[model samples]
Target: MDLYIFCRMVLQQKALILLVTVVVAALASAYAFLVRPEYQVSSVLRPAAINELDALNRSEIYQLPSGDALIKVGASLESYETRLGFFRANQKLFKNFERPGRTLEQSFEEFNYNSIKLVVPDAKNAGSLNAYIKLVMNYPEGVAGVAILNGFVQYAIESQRQQIAADMEVIVRNRLSELAGRLDSARSSYVTDKAAKIAKLTEEDNLKRAQLQDELKALRAQLKNQRADQIAQLNEAIGIAKSLGIQKPSTPSSLGGAGVQGSQPVMRTEVNNQQIPLYFMGVDALLAERAALLQRKSDDFTEARIAQIAKELQLLQANREVEVLNQRKNEDLFLSGVQPLRAEEVRLRNLNVDMSGLKLVTIDKKAIDPLGPVKPKKMLLIIIGIVFGLMLGLVAAFVRGTDQSRRENSSDTTLLPHSSIPAKKALLSNVEAL
Candidate 1:
């Protein structure tokens, strides 16, 4: 129950307790002495700016540069771990040969697998990994551990870099190709539509020009005909007046005297029952003929010319407005639709190429050889041994004391039943045996 009582019980069976304690302690001490000491060597590597630099060089359209780099790093680590198993197997060189009965292979296997602790520290405590890596690489012994670790790290980094390069190149190239295809299609459509529009506008412009020319020519002919008719009519009126015996006033005084004389007959020429005054009739007919010519010129010549000119001008204006509108539409489409799309296509193509390049990148040394064994910490082993020995000693003491108590209780029980019978026989037997 209590420690004191337990100790007293063990003391009562001191011989057996002492024997068991000695055996357990000796066995535990021997085990601790025979076990090999192990040292830990680790290394750390920070994700470099190599991926970012590569992306910048390749293209401006990076979707996830940082995420890509992290993914590459993780994949590289996985590959390294998988490939380094063979290197870990070679840790037998570090095994101590002081124990001839144990092979280095057997001892090394025990140390390598269960003992080694390869840790990747958190970002905040990443310095620890770096320190560990440096220690392993720089370990004094020219052992397989260091060689393997160096090889693994070098190969892994190189492989990862190559793969990233290849991937970047592929991605950029593919994107560019896709963009090029789209641009080609757009260019073809634009060329086709432009040709059609140009043809239509040219035809309309030619027709308007022809119509204006025809209308102008007809107006000129009409004007010439009206002028000829007016001239003929004027000449005839002058002749008729001459034939009717009408005297022309030679002087302003004569004309005024004629107008004042009441007895002067109003000289009239009658034609087709229409009386024409001999004095003013010729002048009136000439004025009417001139007005008719002027009216014909205004109607057929001047007005036709103005109307044709206005129509032609309107067509020209429409054509110019259409050209201007088409030009603006073309420019807007180029800037808003085509140019940006083309630029994007080019950008994506470049990025794809970059990603392809990254994919081809390879680590020169994926893993490094650990310079020292990464197992069986010596002080820890010794401390563990001591603890094991104490526990075994206590257990041995308890077992020995429990066996001793059983023997004592059996002896007391047998003696209690035999005590009365043995008392009567004790006197006779004591006398006879004496």
Candidate 2:
């Protein structure tokens, strides 16, 4: 019933009970001692700053995302880890541990794969501070299991930084190159256009010169025709005078005096007169008139032609001047438009160079080694062992108590008391003999 009574009964049969208890307890302790200890190692890491986002913000490219902090952090971490060769290194770890069932490499791989934990501390401290705390906790020697975890974390961070720098450099170089190429193309096009414009202007100038020459030629031909007409008229007048036999009047004074004495001055007639003297005089007068008209027309035509030619030449010169000015203006515009682009390209190139230098100088923080074992906490293991041993001892005691009770009950049932027995038949027979 009581523990003392039960223990006493077992002690009375102490040899067997002791033997069973010793065997059971020994086996349990042995099993507990033989069991492998599991160690827990942990390291903390915070996501790296997103340089791209920073750049975008600084450049005022676009609006930032809403309060999706987790998504943003995850995306940033993933991008950062990828740059750092996290997956590649993980694959390598997996490959190295390849074996039939189990191996050290496999163990290590499991530790790496399973040991990582990501947590956001609080809403108040979001990016930088949270990352910092995570970094501190993950430091190699600072916390349990942190040392082993720190190596991978360091590798991941360094790898990420290197990758980011590389990507940035490549992007900057490509962009600068594209800008440079575009600037060069623009300059070339501008030059070609300017050349074409100048050539067109030259062609127009040549055409204008030819037109002026043609006008001059037409004016000269018109003058020559007028002179020819005047000559023909003069010759006709001379021929008519000769046919009329109108000789030159000799002794004009003697003919005039005789003619004056009469009512009408006697017409001084030539010996070879073909028509009346008045007709000859009229023909001569007509010739003179024709000559005068021709001379006047020639003079007027020449003056008008000269004035027109001069005005046209002035107009052509003015147009040519305007064309030259236009070409100059276009050239100036081309230079103005292209020069800034070239300068910008140069500036971008220089900035890229500086950025590359800075990237080259950047370095990752070094990892520290742990001074104590990070896993398989001894105190926790001991405490768990003690509790399990106590539980097993109690179970053994309960089972032993039950078995003893059954044995006692069986023995009592097998051995009967003398008070309950019947009187012997021999005693009755003896009484009859007496």
Candidate that scores best on TM-score: 2
User: Which lDDT tens digits does candidate 2 get at residues 1-434?
Assistant: 46676566555655555555566556555555555533334344333345524443342222233223224433444443442345346554434334578764555455345545444467677664444223322222223343334555545445534554565567667877887778677768877876787677767866986787788777777777867776676567667656754344333333345435546546555454354333244444656766676656344354476677767767666455446645564453545466666766666565532222221111123235445444445556555656655555555655676676666655654465565333323433332232
Each model's lDDT: 0.54, 0.51
Rate residue 195 of model 1 by lDDT: 70
* Model 2 TM-score on a 0 to 1 scale: 0.55
lDDT by residue for model 1 over 277-324, one digit each (tens)?
333355555656666676563454345465757667576755774566
Candidate 1 global CA lDDT score: 0.54
Least lDDT summed over 10 consecutive residues: which range in candidate 1?
A: 131-140
The pairs that clash in candidate 2 are: 39-376, 41-145, 42-145, 44-138, 84-159, 84-160, 244-274, 245-272
